[model samples]
Target: MTAPIFPLSAVVGMDDLRLALVLNAVSPAIGGVLVRGEKGTAKSTAVRALAAVLPAVEVVSGCRFSCDPADIDPDCPDGPHDFAGPRESRPARLVELPVGASEDRLVGALDIERALAEGVKAYEPGLLAAAHRGLLYVDEVNLLGDHLVDLLLDAAALGMSYVEREGVSIRHRSRFLLVGTMNPEEGELRPQLLDRFGLTVEVAAPREVDARAEVVRRRLSFDADPTSFAAGFSAAESELASRILTARELLAQVALPDAVLRQIASVCASFEVDGLRADIVIARTAVAHTAWEGRSVVDGDDVRMAARLALPHRRRRNPFDAPGLDEEQLDNALDDHSNDDDPHDDGPGGAPAPQDSPAPADSSSPTDSGSAPERPMPAPGESFAAPTDTFRTRRLEVPGVGSGAAGRRSRAKTDVGRVTGSSRPTGKAGRLHLVSTMIAAAPQQKARGRTSAGLILRRQDLRLARREGRESNLVLFVVDASGSMAARSRMGAVKGAVLSLLLDAYQRRDKVGLVTFRGDSAELALPPTSSVDTAAARLTVLRTGGRTPLAAGLLRAREVLRVERLRDPRRRALMVVVTDGRATRRGGGDLEDAYRTAALLAAEGTAAVVVDCESGPVRLGLAGKLAMALGGPAVRLEELAADTLAASVRTFTGAA
Candidate 1:
């Protein structure tokens, strides 16, 4: 028996998420929804439930591609003649594209061997075909491979698929409501892919006691008796489905007035959004909203709602910056262009509305810390300092090929990356490199003395694709915030350096944690997280002063990393220690204690880099010695600067 889906009408809160899904159903051209939220936030539940409420679709009987009887695809791989074909109505289908699914499974595969030997044009259908005129949902979309994402967005945008892999080319209509649910904590979709989404909604579990309780109550009831719970909401579900159908029909009648158009164009301009895509999306969404509300004309209110859904993902300046629309600016634009019909207004589509590192952690590389000289241990004090500025930094990478999380740092082998070559499969052949397999199979065709004239491919000929792509690493920053290095200007620069490193981490998609040593002990300033914004928040509020207990800081970081490895053992790590390398203690052995802790990290082969903050004609060189102890290089802060990087490299090379 088919499992009952949680009724869409029964879902609580998440008003924006529900509306976004409805809007797309009303008009697929409005594009799809990118639902962002934490796990258990009903991101997937809402999507799956929507399939239940969606109006049933009518397709030509016996059509695997789900062709609309009114307009059959002439180029469909499974086609001949059209209008007279039997038609049937069924509930709209929801197709899922799993993260580990291969390319052959997504776009369907062609029987190359059959064609070469038997002269047959046999083709197999894939998920894109199955999802035709229905809905396609990709859960955990952020974790989906970049190459797969490109394919999804392309099919969504073009409304068709042109499968040209393995020498078999086929075309078919594939218009579906593309919905993706992602947890930002995993990582993020590239901005280019993000902008392709027409609407974006951020969701979270209800915080109110009553609201959360209601959610749990409904969930428990459904889990215990899905059919009974669905039956209870049958009336509400029927009403929503009827409303969606009516909205779909009403969409064509809704008018987009000149003034509403002006508001959309104006709002997009004010936000400085990069392209006219946002404007187009808002216009379509506003029209859909007007129809959805049982109205005939698009109005300012409709535009406002549309802008709320369409502009957040488009206006983000950086991934770390949360997605938001400045309502004040939005209102100003609407008011500013409320009454205007200037042909020279640079109207929509007239022009572009928009606007729009690896570094090694090794000690020899120039890295973290300020340029200030060592100062006396004065009275411990605290201050919250903002980052001085941000600039592009050289890429810092861990020294080996890794098989870690998707990131832009150190290179690793991944199924979706560029194929360097091919290898014989050791286990189950997951990513079969077809051409290589065919090449190996060719020699055996004649040697086996096969009765058949075709190429004789066998299991022994299977080859897996060997691809190379970059992987994200765990970057733990250990900073010295003790009194000995706590001059106001010096500490600010040190924090600035740390902040800069944080930005680098953000860009590289590295999970980052911060450890600060001062006073009597060290604290985990921020736990390692995919969210760089959180780390930066903690960094800005950090205080300086107190005796440096460097050992404690390294120890804390080691503990955090240990826990993290147990959580995700695939991720490699890079330790960045920002210090002047001074450890003062009332009980003594401070420096020795610090060294011993560093040795433990070195023993684990943790990639390390110490940014020597000490500067003067005379130096203690403690930071360099610490770097040596950690089995990494130590470089001055200025060396982290991009412009001076080449000069530093030349200096090191000349010395060598």
Candidate 2:
């Protein structure tokens, strides 16, 4: 049995989040709201609670697609026009979006039942249809499929869904509150999709001991006796619902002055936010907030609150940059609007005011009233974070044996066994043109006297499947962390270089693993992962000492790559070894053994790069020799910056 929802009021702290959700609930025209935080932040709980408290929606009775009663379509499958029933009010629904949902399943598809039973073309509304006039909740939305994300963005933007499949083309209203929850650590949404959300809320775990204890207490109480616990908050829930209803009724009457709109645009311009979407979203949310407060007119406070939610994701140039809105700057912008005649205030298209500008105390939270601290500029010749553009458009091409997964490659004969249901004939192996096939078979079914058999099947009807060109690669980083090479600066440089290459690995759609050799033998310091954060965590506190054991590290990397190849032969492996080829294997170590293993790597056709970090006048050139044996080029340690090294490796592997 499903557990009862925890009341929104009982949610401890997260005043910012609660208010954002309430505003969106009051006025979904604010687009949708995104909740970003670490795990266990009650992101999902808050979304569900919003659903539970939402006012009932009046939908056409027996409408399979949940069509609005006021705007019922005449061609609905249930025949609302011919034998329509009275409109009925139903509780607002919470529709969960599955991560692996297909495009057909997300949008509507051709109804197989009606087609097979009655030889009639019909539509089967998907989740998008069911979510009309309701909440479409997506948890871990960042991890959702890319195609699905695109579909959602288009649907949310248009407030209607359009689907063409199996000779059936249909479009229907799909307006809904798109509430998405994501742990920023897991991954990220594309900027295009990110900006689609009208508001974004960042939540943190309760810091106060008392507040944390309260959260645990309420959670335990709810889990132990949900019925009794929910009963306790019933009155509060009902009141909140009524407030939302009143807010909706008052939304149309809420006033946003021309000055307020200018202030909104000026604030976005100050932040250099891209496009005018931020300005529009802020205006809509400000109006929603005004309605929520039972106020007739939007004030500076409403705009500030709206900016807090709408500007974060939109203003950022990169995903990793902190979500920022200098409260002092924003307040000055609002203040400047009051005095548009002042020349100094309009410095360089309204230059940002002094950082020391005082901020008015927020009535909601005293602790959050202070002006936000300015973002620290990076020092000269220093890098803060990797730019997404560096990796976003890059693709890694692995050697292909035949038709395989989806990516960039020449089309080959398709494997019928691997055929997916998608109608888009990717590559050259997919079945005959889907549209043409449907058209060819459409008119002859009735004359053939087998209409009830659901069209016709024959060998000639079978179209050859097309192959999709998808490629994936794995990068294994083998680093030497022996005491001889553990100089703090050397290790730091090595770590930085690896991080740079990892960015390329991410862009190439490749998995990465790290192996470190020190002490007795080599150890797999980090497992294969696509997440840069995961690799960074393992590299930060990596210990460095003991014998080199280059042989053991080489053997370990070879074994790992071998296993990976066995699992998926199509995935190519590239080993980038960061080491100064000095070897002193603990008990059974041998320099010759390492050289032999390097040759074996070459024999196995595994791409390799040996970064020679041996910086001394009296160098033995063992790293150069190792690189030769492995049939890969050696890169000088001094030449191993992120971009340079990534380009060098990509050029070497032909993956650029």
Candidate 3:
């Protein structure tokens, strides 16, 4: 059955997600967006909505490659098809990556039937070929096979795919906008691979009650009448297309100001972000933002908006430290630089003096002013410069009773309560002293006319040993229940993967928990428990829908861990996220807010592993991007199921 089309404007709350789609539509150079959130966060809806409204592209007919006739480069090896007069027409394509697809299916393979029947080698085009001059979307991208990921990455980077197998070498253009969605609960993406994405935004469930209601309302309405629902928003979709075209034209003339460039740098620097990728992304994103606003010059607001998207994914200095710049720090830096000089003030040399002002208040502080008297205002001609204060540092203190102290107290309390006159068992078997038993027997013998005195009790005569059992580790399964996961058969594959993992968890005797996020909520399906049967059953019935609520899921998983009693006796907590990495529902495309949620979970010391389920033509999506943002390990399901799952789990549990 064909899927119903979703309206673009009806998608609730992710302005950044919408903007990212619009910008990319206008200028693919602005790069792709990474939507990070938990399940049901509407990640897939926005992407599909985008596809529904995407402008049609003119391509050469009968050309499976979707080659643009007008923009054909001189290097075209196809050798200039006749286009001097009339040309055939073709519509833009939107290709989806299926979960169970193989390398041969995705990157084209040797024509087996042709080789056997005709004795000739031929290469069959794959999804990449079909997606040329269109959109290639991978839902749950993090779970994609490594070879497949490599293939897509190669094609995306080179704008072409070269397939060589069975004595056939074929090269073709595979340029297309790649969009991938994932849930961080699945796993994470590799850093080397993650750097390919141009922009990343974290999505979340709508915080406002009304927004969430609207989301549900629209979804229900669409489900009730798909055709009418799609038609209802046709006008708005047309308007959106016009706006995108306007933005595309404006993008060419947009100029990023020097001040905005410095502001972008300042934001990145304040975050102690690694590499210069953040700055570059910020600059490019700012230009896109300006274009989205139909402006020719990048403004301060453009830089601010870009910072929210680009800076979040680049702050990798501390993975557990959150995904983006600290707003308080950013605000302080901006204010510091902006108020660095005051023209109205006068200096001793009759020149304007710099303003001497106190630093901005802390985010949690009530206000900058309190009982302290305000500094005296500088005279009209007097220089007023305050010494810059070094940044202050706060230390975290954790209090707990030492093991030795607890043991001593227990021993002391037990000694005081013991019955002094009563005999107790002692020695290897914790049995009565053998010599004492013999002595008592001898006394009984003596009463019957037998006596002995040379026997003495030995240490071996006492018993005091107890067997100890091995400890169990707690494993948290953070599954992505986002709408993208519901697309095609990805959800079925994810369910199969989860079931397989649950079997392993059961064999290992590890406690497991289940968390799912979709729409505007994240729910703990099951808390950490040793009841493997129940947990596995619940997981088997898991369904996917709504947005990717990544942040909420991470936070909830952490909270679940906190309440779980598995942090001692050589046991550690591990988080395994099975997702595609499309966070389209959380924080409404506000990367900073989404990162804040992820950072909180990481800061609590949860060892997170992200499993990318994004199959077919690869797009990193927000899941992998967030994994990089959190500095977590990311692996594909194929990689995990093939080579790493058992080994990685053993290593993590110190069993290897």
Task: Please provide, for model 2 over 555-599, each residue's C-alpha lDDT reduced to its tens digit, 9 standing for 90 to 100.
Answer: 999989888878777656768899998899656646899999999
Off by over 4 Å in 3: 1-4, 73-80, 83-91, 317-319, 335-656
State residue 409's C-alpha deviation in candidate 3, in Å. Answer: 45
How far is 311's C-alpha from truth in model 2 (Å)? 2.8
Model 2: how large is the Cα RMSD against the reference?
Answer: 7.9
Q: Give the clash count for each candidate.
A: 14, 10, 65
**Comparison by lDDT, 2 against 3, better one:** 2
For the record, the alpha-carbon RMSD of candidate 3 to the native fold, in angstroms, is 27.1
Better of 2 and 3 by TM-score: 2
Best by lDDT: 1
Per-candidate Cα lDDT values, in order, are 0.81, 0.73, 0.62
Alpha-carbon RMSD to native, per candidate: 7.0, 7.9, 27.1
Candidate 1 residue spans exceeding 4 A from truth:
58-63, 67-75, 79-90, 111-122, 162-164, 170-173, 185-188, 206-225, 319-329, 339-380, 427-432, 453-459, 586-600, 615-622, 642-656
Tens-digit lDDT track for model 3 on 562-631?
Answer: 7773455334566778887766664476345557766776776666767887877767666667666555
Best by TM-score: 1
